[model samples]
Target: MLASFDIGALGHSFWALTISGLTYGSIYALVAVGYTLVYGVLRLINFAHSEIFMLGMFGQYAALMMFGFAPQGDAYDMGVAQTLMYLGLAMIGGMVVSGAAAVGLERVAYRPLRRRGAPALVFLITAIGASFVLQEFVHFVLPKLTNNTLGGLNAQQPIRLVSPSTQFTIFGATVTNVDIAIVVSALALAFATDRFINGTKFGRGIRSVAQDPVTATLMGVSRERVIMLTFLIGGVLAGAAALLYTLRVPNGIIYNGGFILGIKAFCAAVLGGIGNLRGALLGGLLLGVMEMYGQTVFGNEWRDVVAFVVLVLVLMFRPTGILGESLGRARA
Candidate 1:
């Protein structure tokens, strides 16, 4: 792959790749938070979380459809105000769907198992099973319900809410309006989440529970509520990410769309230190940039391999990750 590589192209598109990488990384960071938060509190991977992200994608699509948007034909060119309004509604729809799915998963699958004092293996199996069930439900059942419009094994085209018009240029790279919206909005949400996790009474409860559930429970923190809240936050972020993702890949919305991204996001969480929020952001940006650079150097076909290789090398050196796992120390 390296033999045919155009090294000069890498230099020429350095800024462009970096910008695109950051955009992709922002989405990864958003999704990674869901994994990290759930892991921190429950010490479980919550494998079904990816499906939650997938559901968010459909939720936003469905919302737009309800607003008179269609899968194909001429793209909508509504005024800026109307476009933002529709986008906002779509995001809210995504959040509600993803949040409800997450909570339901916990209540129906994990919570009952936890109450029964099930082993770690049982929880892991259940999570994996739940993930498949959700995906298949979307794949086989949802398409039928939407008259083959929203779901199924086929990829659904999202209504183009934001046209990717070039907004600015930096260091020879042209940035689009969608790029700015995705990066800025994702950063804002990440910052707000960090603040909420570190600055609120509920945030304290979450950290306390993550540190020690028994002690936190004794101290009057409701474990169930904290778990629910963590899932809700994760879902909301994922929902927002779904909107941003649609902006990036309008034709890429499908049941399996979230699978690879979800894996990458999980990799990002581990790369950043699985339980660390700031680490997820850092890891995501780093991974995205590195993956883009890898594509430039190793060719597009090797991009995914390069990403996983980097992950392995990082783990070989620092298993705890770049910042280390410490939900408790995050506030400090």
Candidate 2:
């Protein structure tokens, strides 16, 4: 087992792995933000959040289909201008669907429990059950709803929007347009989210509720409103991540596609500090980079193992995570 490990691969492809890792890390960071945000406000794990991500994938694909772009083996050859327009539209479509679904999930699955003063364990179980319900809906119901055009047992044929082309080289690693786009878009969204959370009045409300729900309620902060906003924001970001993810892996939009990725994102949230926004970002990038390195050294098959092991080791040493800060304690 020791001899099978190839440490030299990391030395040879350090830059390559780093760039690739950052690209994936960006996606993970976006999805992990949702996990962190929901946990911060509700202290709920939101296991069904991954299913929301999956729906966003399908939502964006449907948007493309509505635009007359059929699923095919190759990407559309439209000019950069048209491609950007369609991509923007697709992103919007995903965001809307995901945002609405998130709100609905809160209303249908969680709000009733909240009214009943359900235990934390009940909420967690509901989240898991909701996740299965969403997945199965897509697996069985979506096909019938869409006349078999959208979701089923297999991955939808890829509808590529931007074909990757090498744009530059860093050290010895090549960077593509897709890599640049994913990283830049993710950073922009994250920055915007941070600013909104820290600077806006609504954001203050969220923080207040998170820090002390009873006090925040006494201060006239509507807990329900804050919770809804949290879910919306998280869902929108997940939708954006879904688009970026599809750009990187076009054929990844299956009914159960979000399962592993969602788990990784949750691990990222825990790794960084579950309720901390900045921590989620940091944890995701670190997880992505480390996972890439582990895959390189151990083999592709070890990728998932590497991610889980990192989570376990982190939990063993620092249960509160790397940052060990809660969202309520975050500085403005």
Candidate 3:
């Protein structure tokens, strides 16, 4: 059996791994927020959410193709202005597609069940079923629909709009333009979401529903509307995360691309406090850094195992997470 740990390599790559981990964690943070928000209000796992993120990936790719980008063997090099435009457009495309898909999912998959007073286990099964349905639809139906132009159970070609060239060194670790963009954009979006959940009237309504749906309904908060909004917010954030994720893994936008990352994002949400927005952000960043450290210490093959182990340990010790609180306690 291979030795379980290797400390020497870790010490050598500490700074580089730290920087890269932060970049990866930022993407997780964005996706985690979606999981956190929907859970906060609905108290549902929304397993099909991974599919929403996957749709965002396809959405942005479709947008890029519409903008005249084509697959090539080598990465595309573009000016900063052009790159920024493409990035903005792709993110927007992703956000729109994901947000719409989420709403449709609510309207179609969960709404009827909710109206019929379905049990939690039933909802869980429905979510999983919806997830597979979306995946299969993309893998099988999309190819025929597009005349084999879009989908076919294969990894999509790389979208190389932005080159990940090193822009500067931070604490002896190289930071690329993509890294800066991912972190800054994710932080900005996270902050905005935090404010939306904790400071606004709508935010108050969401918290009220989370705390006591019947009371909120009696107070004139539309429960149905809140649920729809929650899904929309989660989907939009997932879509943003999808673009950032593609930036990190240029060729990773496959039909099942979101499954593993989505699970990690959910783990981040749970690690931080399942129903807490800021907690999800904290959990994501921590998980990313820890995963990198684990990879360095135990080799790349153990990267994911390390993350899951951390999750199990965290749950065993501090089940409420680092910033333990539900959405109701967010502003409290």
Each candidate structure's TM-score, on Cα atoms with residue i matched to residue i, is 0.97, 0.98, 0.97
Q: To one decimal, what is the Cα RMSD in angstroms of model 2 from the true structure?
A: 1.1
Error of 2 at 303 (Å): 0.8
What's the lDDT for residue 119 in model 1?
98
Local error of candidate 3 at residue 29 (angstroms)? 1.0
Best by TM-score, which number? 2
Please provide, for model 2 over 1-332, each residue's C-alpha lDDT reduced to its tens digit, 9 standing for 90 to 100.
Answer: 53358989899999999998999999999999999999999999999999999999999999999999999989789998999999999999889888888999999999999999999999999999999999999999999999999999999999999999999999968999999999999999999999899999999999999899999999999999999999999999999999999999999999999999999999999999898998899989989999999998998889999998998999899999998757898574
Best prediction by lDDT: 2
Among all windows of ten consecutive residues in candidate 1, which has the lowest summed lDDT? Answer: 1-10
Q: Where does the lowest 10-residue lDDT sum fall in candidate 2?
A: 1-10
- Evaluated at residue 155, the lDDT of candidate 1 is 88
Expressed as tens digits, the lDDT of each residue in 1-332 for candidate 1 is: 36557778889999999999999999999999999999989999988888899999999999888888877744688897998899899999888999899998899999999999999999999989999999999899998887888788778865888778898899989999999999998999999999889998988989999998998999999999999999889888988888889888888788888888988888899999998999999888888998999888878888888778878989989998888898866453
Q: What is the C-alpha local distance difference test score of candidate 2? A: 0.93
Number of clashes recorded per candidate? 0, 0, 0
Could you give candidate 3's per-residue lDDT for residues 182-255 as a string of tens digits? 99999999999888888889889888998889989999999999999999999999999999988888888888
Model 3 lDDT, full chain set: 0.89
